[model samples]
Target: MVKHGISLVEAARRLGVSQSTLYIALQKGQIPTFRRDGRTVVSSGALRDYQTGKRPPCAYRL
Candidate 1:
């Protein structure tokens, strides 16, 4: 997972969203992420999964 990890900012940029928005998605379990060096990071595969619709938004349904 280390090799596939990227900083949250970079991931946000790649996804064309703000860091805070991405962070919220991470916190909501809408995105796959893990802590690295005490900071949250996202995997390239996770990003791909998101783009491919393998991951879904976690907004409240009720």
Candidate 2:
């Protein structure tokens, strides 16, 4: 069967960011994610939106 989403590591690689940075973004709600087959994954569309600025990054609060 084909996968609907990509692994977190792949997502980080595509975004050219470290896994820790991606994790922080996930925690801050900057990036959305879901669990599939017991593993966390991110949708390609969402990643594209983020890259294109369609999904603006969340503001950091002090």
Per-residue accuracy of model 2 over 35-57 as CA lDDT, tens digit each: 88999899998888878877656
Give the number of the best model, judged by TM-score: 2
lDDT of 1: 0.80
Per residue, candidate 1 scores C-alpha lDDT tens digits across 1-62 of 13558888899999999988887777777777877778778888898898787886676432
Instruction: Evaluate candidate 2 by giving its C-alpha RMSD to the native, one decimal.
Output: 3.0
Model 2 per-residue lDDT at 52 = 81
Model 2, stretches more than 4 Å misplaced?
1-3, 56-62
Q: Estimate each model's TM-score.
A: 0.73, 0.78
Q: Report, for every candidate in turn, its global Cα lDDT versus the true structure.
A: 0.80, 0.83
Off by over 4 Å in 1: 56-62
lDDT at 58 for candidate 2? 68
